[model samples]
Structures are given as C-alpha cells and as structure tokens.
Target: MEALTLTTPALLFSAVSLILLAYTNRFLGYASLVRQLYEKLKANPDQVLLDQIMNLRKRLYLIKNMQLLGVASLMFCVLSMFLIYIEVFLPAAYAFGLGLLLLIISLLLSGWEIKISVRALDLHLNDMEHFSEDNS
Candidate 1:
C-alpha cells in the first residue's frame, strides 16, 4: 500500500461538501412537504394521505442517516489528514479507507431514497389516473 498523503484526504473535501449540500436541500424539501401534508391530514383524514405521510417518514429517516454518514465520512477524512500530518502512515491509510467506505455507504443509501421517491411519485400518478377515470 502506498503511503497516505494529506492531499489524498483533502481531495474528498469538495465532493463531500457538495454531497452534504445536496442532502441538506433534500431535507429542507421534505420538511416543507411534511408541513403541507400535516395541514392536509388535519383538515380531512384519508388513507392515501396517511400512506403518503408514512412514505415521507421513511424517506426522512433515510435522508437523516445519509447525512449522518456523510458527515462521519468527512470527519474520518479530516482525521486521516491529521494522522498523515503527524506522520502516522498506517493509521492514516486506515482512516482514509474508512472514509471512502463510509462515502460509498452514504451514496448507496441516497440511491435507496431515490428509489422510494420514485415509487411515491408513481403512486401519486396512479391516484391521478384513478381520479381522471372517475371524472370521465
């Protein structure tokens, strides 16, 4: 294995920062939707609305976890840089590897959340189709 350099861990800074930004945007969007849904549910309780809320709840959980992991990955990268700075090569390598692993896991969870989002959209489309048929 090659010796870990400070530059190696520094490389992740921009990528991870962008990812965290995206995650924050997603979280904010969900928060807005949750508020809207809450008002709707309060006005007239429906199973479809309940289901949507449940789906949102799950997505929100996933997003939270993804953000957590992403932040942890960034932390590890920083640690790796610090270790390398202190000339502890082996542990620096290990920290960098762990950071990469955490990043991969975070990305996987983001993909899973996207799948759920697509499914929710499909469900909404199905409902729209049913409503159109009834009106027709």
Candidate 2:
C-alpha cells in the first residue's frame, strides 16, 4: 500500500479554506438575525427596539473589522503559499495559523453580538408585559 504525502503548502491551503468556510457560515447566520431584528423593529419601537438597533450597529462595526481581518489574513495566506515553494514550512504554518485565529475571533464576536440582541429583545418583552399589567 502506498501512502500519499501531503505537502506543506497543501496543508496550509486546506486549513485556510476551512476557516473561510466557517467564517462565511457565521456571516450568513448574522444576516438572518439582522433580518429578524428588522422585523421586530417594524412591529414597534420601544426602549428594547432602540437597544437592538444600537446593538446591531455595534455588531456591524465588528463585522467590518472581521471583514478587514479576513482580507488581511487571506493576503498572508497567499504569501505563505508562495513561500512554501521555497520549502519554508514554518512561516506558512504561522500565516495560516494567524488566519484561523482571526476567523475564531470573528466567530466569538458574532456570538457576543447575538447575546446582546437577545437581551435587548428580552428587556423589551418585559417592559411590554409590565405596561399591560399596570393597565389591569
């Protein structure tokens, strides 16, 4: 049986691709959340709705940073791939690792953003319930 040996460049490319795929998936989920938030806003505007908007804006800023980081990471990954032709494995690995780290950071930021959004909605729901009780 013959075993296939994967080159360093190939391994780095694989890792970078996986990170990009995961990042893309995270963005899609965020987009869906944004849509839901919009629908909630259309239903009514209250302190909770205001909070959601503020939270969304903050998350959008993070998304911008994530995009910027992703672009830089891609550039580094490409450079590292080229370096591999010179048999430089360590540097390529480092670049690929940086890209993965950026992706993980973006994912963590997204999770925080979602938590803020949920909390804002919860606050709004509680306020509405309280107001209804006051009228009873």
Candidate 3:
C-alpha cells in the first residue's frame, strides 16, 4: 500500500462537510415536523397522528446516529491527518480506514432512514387515495 499522506484524509473534508450539512438540515426539518405534530395531537388526538409521530421518532433516532457517526468520521479524518503530519504512518492509515468505515455506516443508515421516510409518505398517499375513493 502507498504511504499514508495528509492529503489522503484531507480529501474527505469536503464530502464529510457536505454530508453533515445535509444531515443537519434533515434534523431541523424533523424538529419542525415534530412540533407541528405535537400541536395537531393536542387539538385532536388520532391513531394516525400517533403512528406518524412514532415513525418520526424512529427516523429522528436514526438521524441522530447518522449525524453522530458522520461527525466521528470527520474527527477520525482530522486525527489521521494529524498523525500523518507527526510521521505516524501506521496509525494514520488505521485512522483513515476507520473514518471511511464510519462514513459508510452513516450512509447506510441514511438509506434506511430514506426508506422509512418514503414509507411514511406512502401512508399519507394511501390515506388520500382512500379518501378520494370514498368521496367518489
């Protein structure tokens, strides 16, 4: 394998930064949805709203984990760069590899969250379809 260089870890900086920004946006959107749901539930408690809230809760948990892993991956990349700067090639390589692994896991969790999100949207669509059918 080629020697670990500072540039190797530095390459992840932009990708990770973009990913973190996306994750933060997702988190903020969920926060807003939760607040809206809370008010709706208070006004008229329904099973469907309860289920949607539960789904959001799960998605929020996954997002939290995703953000945590992404941040950790970025931290590892920085650490790898620092290690390489100090002439610790072996540890630097390990750190870089771990950072990559964390990033991969974070992305996988993101995919799972997206799937859940789609399912939630599907539920809403189904409800609309049923309502239309009944009206028709």
**Model 3 Cα displacement at 124 (Å)?**
0.5
Task: Candidate 1: give its CA RMSD in angstroms.
Answer: 0.8
On residues 1-136, what C-alpha lDDT tens digit does candidate 3 reach at each position? 6788788899997799999999999999999999999999999999999999999999999999999999999999999999999999899899999999999999999999999999999999999999999999
lDDT of each: 0.95, 0.67, 0.96
In TM-score terms, candidate 1 sits at: 0.97
Across 1-136, the per-residue lDDT of candidate 2 in tens digits comes to: 2221235435645665665576577667768877887898789767765766677678667666666666666676676676666667677667666766765675676577668767767887898999999999
Checking candidate 3 for backbone clashes, the offending pairs are none
Top lDDT hit: 3
**Runs in model 3 with CA error above 4 Å?**
none
**Backbone clashes in model 2:** 0
The C-alpha stretches of model 2 lying farther than 4 A from their native spots are 1-49, 131-136
Weakest 10 consecutive residues of candidate 1 by summed lDDT: 1-10
Off by over 4 Å in 1: none
The lowest-lDDT stretch of 10 consecutive residues in candidate 3 is 1-10
TM-score of predicted structure 3: 0.98
Candidate closer to the true structure by TM-score (higher is better), 2 or 3: 3
Looking at candidate 3, what is the lDDT of residue 17?
A: 92
